[model samples]
Target: MKVLVTGSQGFIGKNLLAELKNKEFPEILEVNRKTEQSTLDKYCKEAEFVFHLAGVNRPEDQSEFMDGNYGFTSILLETLKKQKNTCPILISSSIQAELDNPYGVSKKAGEDLLFEYSEETGAKVLVYRLPNVFGKWCRPNYNSAVATFCHNVAHDLSINVNDPSVEMNLVYIDDLIGEFINALNGKENTRGDFCEVPVVHVTTLGEIVELIYSFKKSREERTIPNMSKAFTKKLYSTYLSYLPSKQFSYDLKMNVDHRGSFTEFIKTPDRGQVSVNISKPGITKGNHWHHTKNEKFLVVSGEGVIRFRRIGTEEIIEYFVSGNKLEVVDIPTGYTHNIENLGETDLVTIMWVNEYFNPEKPDTYYLEV
Candidate 1:
């Protein structure tokens, strides 16, 4: 299919073009702010489908709204008409078109013109009146509050929220792309006269800011946010994408001694915690027993022997472990256990506990194994 995409450098247009290329669509003609009129005319003549995404939403002058939105639509339609090309054209209209503001008025006028053109030429038109759309690559501190909040919080910058309770209806960019591809395949989700992206998340400005702040703090706290909620999962992913390239890696506080270092890697409220432990050669650790806490240890380097014994038993059980053959040793409650590095090199082990350790009541007792 010979597809023509206007505003090819725009946030939505960039995402759509990437997916089209992934799908291996043949012959894509791009039109942007720098595209020449003659090139657009040639593209209009050969385009089998058109994605009209260029528009002005944040113009410095109010008069530019009509000129950029409605006026551009008129020019594109006229060019297509001159070539007698009546391909399926999908226009990205805003839900604000239902209002009477300058930008809304211009968008509504463009929609009206597309409807008229479709009627006159018997062409297929898919008009999507989208709500607040957000995702990765969206410009920060602009029209999208979600993008601004994510960027600001990730960078430790302050955000101004005039109305904490203001509710916003957001459609993820991936979801919008999915619906657009559906329209390309003639399977649009139409509601009355306009098309809609099926998935929408309704949230308040306060909630969005709170979640973004939590995401920022997750690194320092070695915590993982709850991702069961679809909106939170998508929002967290978007927040990480805005992190500075130089700040991609963060340092963890490692507890070090002659026996080596132990570092907490990640902690979750419901999934317990993971830690990395390193012991020097001939060093023994964990000569203790837990009342209720249990753990699993996997030696990833060197050689070690884990010794275990029931609190009331005198017999000691030993499990020899080595990096050559990976294995996990379970530490059951009420059993005194200790791991001793037997190799010449340091022993590294990954440990997973059922719960986060509490210093107030550790439930640990000293014992010999």
Candidate 2:
């Protein structure tokens, strides 16, 4: 079904769009404050549902919040009311709407306007009050506490917490997106004028901070250096993996060709041959070296650390792997290397080699680790 989604550029909106697309929603008409009227009207007319999610989420000025959130929503509702053919309207409200903050007040006003418009126009309306949603591709900044916390922890930075014991409920972004898709599909019957809707309550700030701190502490205890890109991706991937839904995991595995079976993707025609297996936790692999081959790998499943020593070099490189990321280190013809599964689940990988596999005279030479 065709759906028009406002605030298409925002975090939640972007995630919702992806979710809908993944579910094979026929078409998505994206709309935002910057979206032109002609474009908005075109999509609204063709859509079977309109998800209103645009407007300023956290404005520095209270008035900006009012104008951007409440005012913009009013205008959109008015426009929809005038449509020759109306569709169900879903407003992406915030849990903050129940609070006293300006951002919350504006969202509350926006919801009120949606109800009023639905009453006047006989349009179906659904409101979703989202809590602290976290997951992949989330921006780390002042706008999102979870993102900021994850960012700091991924970088080995200390997390400052006002209270470390409070607990809060966290709704994964994928879960929130699933709810929106469910709403659009009419999986849940709607009452007249408005629906009671679903609200996800997240943990208290202290609890959230502690969770992140625990991850950081674990990484440190393992003597894993935060290797920028690879490590950050690993942490984020792990965070997403913990979400209580298989929708994302399934899609990711498909995209990465992770079928719980070994597969090899040749990087160059003759330079390398690479194969990977998704093994259970605590399984140690690759305690061997090549006399003439070099290799590289990226962890695509659970977390782990690699310990390697180069010939004629007293220093050893200890690297941690997590998430979905690429890590490269040369074997220098004859150096001992091995990786330990530090995570609880199977360790997965996309490994690359400098030469094709040969059973006999195979580049690999066994070494004691």
Candidate 3:
């Protein structure tokens, strides 16, 4: 079905478009702020579903709020009303509309305009009043307190609230998207009905902040090497007792072994090795090569192409490896390579490396093949 999404560049709009794409919905016309009225009308004419989301939620001036929120929606509704075939238009209103803020007042005006237009012209208008939404890809400066808390927690900063007791409902962005999808897929016979949509109260602000604190604390605990004196002493005693020879050197050594054949060993250290594995069929791994570290690969299973290009040169090298005929191939530093798994099963490889990986100072460079 053809769907037209307005304000497709905004935070919520971008996410909603992604969700629609993932669902394999056909023909999603993204209408951004730069979209002209002519262009919008053209798409709306062909669309079976129109999601009117173009509007400024927060404005510095109250007058600007009217122009952005109410004005933009009114124009869009009028355009749809002018169409020969009336399509189901879903308007994303805000819970703020029920409140006394200027932003809320403008949204309420838009909502009223939609209902009036719907009644006069037999337009299928479904209004969704959303609460505070939170999830991945959320921005902090926006009207989402949960997102602000998440960002603060991610940076290991303590969250301080002006009113910790204030209870605010939180709904996941994906859940909000689900509600939109359900409304979109509902039968046409239920179009004109003024449905009191369900509001999902996922969590309060206090609970959300506490959850962030707990997650941050857990992450911090994992980083402490020597947890306690008693634990360290016990570990040392066990290590000494396990040694078979008395002539063993005081030099500490660590060895790590990775399970599975698909992992390509890049560097082998005393304790462990760095590895890379491509699980998707017909998908390529790194397109870049490292200059400072040597990499060894053993294809455990499946089949794929290992393509490499030398640094500063356009020369390309290709290798086809499979699980049964597994061999350790050393990719020297200064060469860029990516592995493409060609088999149905996971194309696994074990990489062994001596140094820890760092993206910023990466000795790796990419070249187009």
Per-prediction CA RMSD (Å):
2.2, 15.1, 17.9
Best by lDDT: 1
For 1-369, candidate 1 gives per-residue lDDT tens digits of 999999889989999999899999988999999999999999999999999999997999999999999999999999999999999999999999999999999999999999999999999999999999999989997789999999888888999999999999999999999999999999999999899999999999999999999999999999998888999999999999999999899999999999999999999888889999999999999999999999999999999999999999999999999999999899999999999999999999999998898999888999888
Q: Candidate 3 on 66-148: residue-level lDDT in tens?
A: 99889988778777767765787888788788899888999899999988987888867888776676665655667767666
Could you give candidate 2's per-residue lDDT for residues 242-338 as a string of tens digits? 3334323221112233324455543333445556656567767777877778877778778988888775566778888886665654445678888
Q: Give all TM-scores, in the order shown.
A: 0.92, 0.58, 0.58
TM-score, cand. 3: 0.58
Per-residue lDDT value at 79 in model 3: 78
Q: Which scores better on lDDT, 1 or 3?
A: 1
Error of 2 at 334 (Å): 38
The models' CA-based lDDT, in order, is 0.94, 0.69, 0.68
Candidates ranked, most accurate by lDDT first: 1, 2, 3
Count of backbone clashes for each model? Answer: 0, 9, 28
